[model samples]
Target chain A: MSDLSVDLGFLKLKNPILAASGTFGYGLEFEPFLDLNRLGGFVVKGLYYGPREGNPPPRLVETPSGLINAIGLQGIGVEAFIAKVLPKLQALDTAVIVNVCGASEEEYVRVVEALDAEEGIAACEINISCPNVNKDGACPAFSPESTRAVVREVKRASRRPVIVKLSPNVTNIVEIALAAQEAGADAIALVNTFLAMAIDVETRRPKLGNVLGGLSGPAIKPIALRMVYQVASRVKVPVIGMGGIWSGADVLEFMIAGARAVQVGTANLVDPDACLRILGEVEDFCRRKGIERLEDIIATVKT
Target chain B: MFKDPEARIVGKESWGDYFLLTFDSPAVSALARPGQFLMIKVSDEPYPLLRRPLGIHSRKDKTLGVFFKVAGIGTALLARKTPGETLDLLGPLGKGFNIDPCLAGKPVLAVGGGRGIAPLYFLAWELRALGASIKILYGGRTQADLPLADKLRAEGFDFACSTDDGTVGRRGLVTELMEDEIKAGGGSPPALVCACGPDPMLQAVALIARDKRLPAELSLESRMGCGFGACWGCVQRIRRDGKAEWIKICEDGPVFPAESVVWEKESP
Candidate 1:
């Protein structure tokens, strides 16, 4: 049998597959389908400083091979999550990574400091892709310079390993990956959902309530792979690649493109046991190739 | 709770733009209740990737019925599927109706308009077994939209229908028909009203249920990613204790009390 264990520089995972944020809900929601412990890790929904009602209704709509969503980070605040949800998630055998989002750098620090003192947090995936809110004569730091600033502040406040989730909306992803590495991010996870929209011809209106939404599914997989390959080859830190990843073959493709680990997002919506099934396929591929370790495929892109 | 079960189609019926896909799924049928939905994989094709959410229309013995309209690519794919072909599905998901036994003697009004009437078919059957009298008041844009009147009557359900253009039945809205019934009441309001339909119709139904001081449950709709509560994709606004709160249409409900829904705001 091949070893699937992955040490993401700072945080260690038994395997490389983890449920992407928002799509998987809390770990308990999928308990009826599969044992949560069977997967390598699970990231809870994006946690913010205050409780958000999220974007208005019609926040999601089905596209050809993707889901367009503008669920603007609706969630239970950090305090409630720590009190009600954290204990149960902590009991699970898999690594529990909290996906944290904020409107500003100060807000990010507040959430990070709170989680920093908490137990059982394997890491924090900083969602820099969240629509940045800046009024101080500056654009939000998803830009290379801006990203370095937030990553530095968040890295100092967070006790757990920090994985800066990169948005694909940026012009040059490699520059941002390098910026995160320079700011001392433990790892980088690319690429967040691509911003896209669909229109309702009959209504003469956009399908989503927010007008624009982040697109995820098999439709975005190729773009995600290309971004992962570009950033992974350039950055020194480990890269956690995710964007419409569905199967074990997709995982291998990401790994071959230099992704140290992967997070499954939209595929979980189609099948709850997607992580387990993909793991099975990965193991099957490993067995067939006589490959002994998962790390062997990292950046081993045949192309 | 079988994970992903392959449902063998036992029957298929074509009614205008609607299609009834009945599958031999004993495990799902045994657990299905009114208001719950099943996510059916349309095909192995990658374009229309997500499974479509069809409300369980009827479940007899080992067979479960899914009545749907060909809305877009996903449902059109489902419409082409034939009997004897197995479909991959995840089932009996979300909170169904809370039909209490105390309301058995009272009449249960099942309201549906157009393709929204699909799930109400199964709900009528279940309500009958529970000893609750069933009255179906379905409406459609035209005569062609009214598909369930005959089936409901054949099952001995007290079925009536209305059409906007007055093609058949009453020449008015189904909500108007319901208002007349409420005005022509016996002693108290009928047990409870369970409804599924377009948002505007449901909003009118909510208003009717509210004015009559009757208990009402609405089978809501939204864009669903994973029908199993994972994506948190489908959400609608509902009032709890005079305060408005947002709830997942896929998780918290595809059904909620009529008054609980804040019909003032448009739902996705």
Candidate 2:
């Protein structure tokens, strides 16, 4: 069997398939669907210092081969996750990555600090690029300065390896990735959903309650691949590519484009067994190509 | 427990815009309960990314049925399926109706509206088998929408229907027929009220159940991303342990106690 394992420098995964944050919930929710041990890892839903009620209804809309959502990062808070969720997750064989989120920089550090005290957390994905919240202003990832500041602070507060998840809604995504890398980010995850909106013609109103949401699915795959290629070529840290990944071929394409690993986002919402299915496809492709180590393909794309 | 499997279509029936497709999916069918639903992949392609959530309409042995109307692109695609086609389905997901033993030998009211009538047929059949006397109240916009009325009656189910245009059993809302039934019963009113329909109709049923002091259960509808708990796309404001909170409709319930539901118009 072809080895599907991928090492992200600071964190080593059994395979390259990870259920993305916000899409996978707490990992416990998917216990009935598939074995968590079979997956490389899964990033849990975003958590703040305290519980959040999230945005109002009409939070999702389906576009052509895509879904736009503005869930506003509703969560049970970091402490609650530690108290309730982490213990259950400690039993699982898969890596548990906690996605840390906050409205302000201090809140981000606070969440990371809380998580730093806990065991069983493989890594912390610092989410400074969530497009659904901070409606009037740009997210931290929008600017290299803010991105650097937040990533540096989170890295300082977090003992676990920090993965800066970057947003695509930027002029220079590579600059942002470099800033995160400079600020001590161990890895980079790109690109968070593209900022998008849809309108209802009959009602003359926005489809989502938050007005705008992050668009993910097959619709954004090509652009995500390009961004991953650009940032991966520039940044020294490992890049976790995601956006519109639907199949095993899609996973290999991202790795070839320069991503060390890949996260399965919108596909999880559509197909519950997407992680394993995509993993199977990856194995089958490797077997067909007579490849032994999956890592041999990372950043091997021809210009 | 739920199963994600490609179920072969064993039966297919169409009545205008409404269609019923039965599948030989033993894994999901054997676990089917009234008010539960299936996340059906309507297309083989990725044009429609999310699966359509359809309620379990009927179950017999290793087969389960789903009845839906051609309301949107997803349902429209589902309606075009043939008897031999295989459907990728995830089910039977979510908490179904609470079949209390206390309901046995008791009078139960099953209210439905439009395609919302999908799960009520299965619910009534189960209630009847449990020795409870079941009365179904089905309503639609017109005669064409009440496609299951004749079939349900043919199966020896006690049924009543209503249409907005007055082309069917009653000229008013199905809630009106329910009120009439309750009023006609005089001293022997229904012990429980169960409803699945449009939000407004469900609200009306909740109000009716409240005024009559009867226990009620309502199957709600929401635009769902995942028919499981992952996406947190479909949420409803519900009161749990005397405190109001947003609950995942896909997992916490597609079925919930009437009193716990906080309606859309109501302030939290």
Top DockQ: which candidate number?
A: 2
lDDT of 2 at A165: 95
Global lDDT of each model? 0.84, 0.91
**Candidate number achieving the greatest TM-score relative to the actual structure:** 2
* lDDT, model 2, position A206: 97
TM-score of each: 0.96, 0.98
Per-residue lDDT of candidate 1, residues B1-268 (tens digit):
4555578888999887888888888888899888899888886755687888888888888988888888888888888989888898988888888879886777888889898888888888778888888888999989889876788778788888999999988889888988877777667667899899998889988887777788899998777888876666788887888888778888889999887888655443
Model 2's DockQ score: 0.76
DockQ of 1: 0.68
For candidate 2, give the docking quality class from DockQ: medium
- Please, what's the RMSD in Å of model 1? 2.4
DockQ for each model = 0.68, 0.76
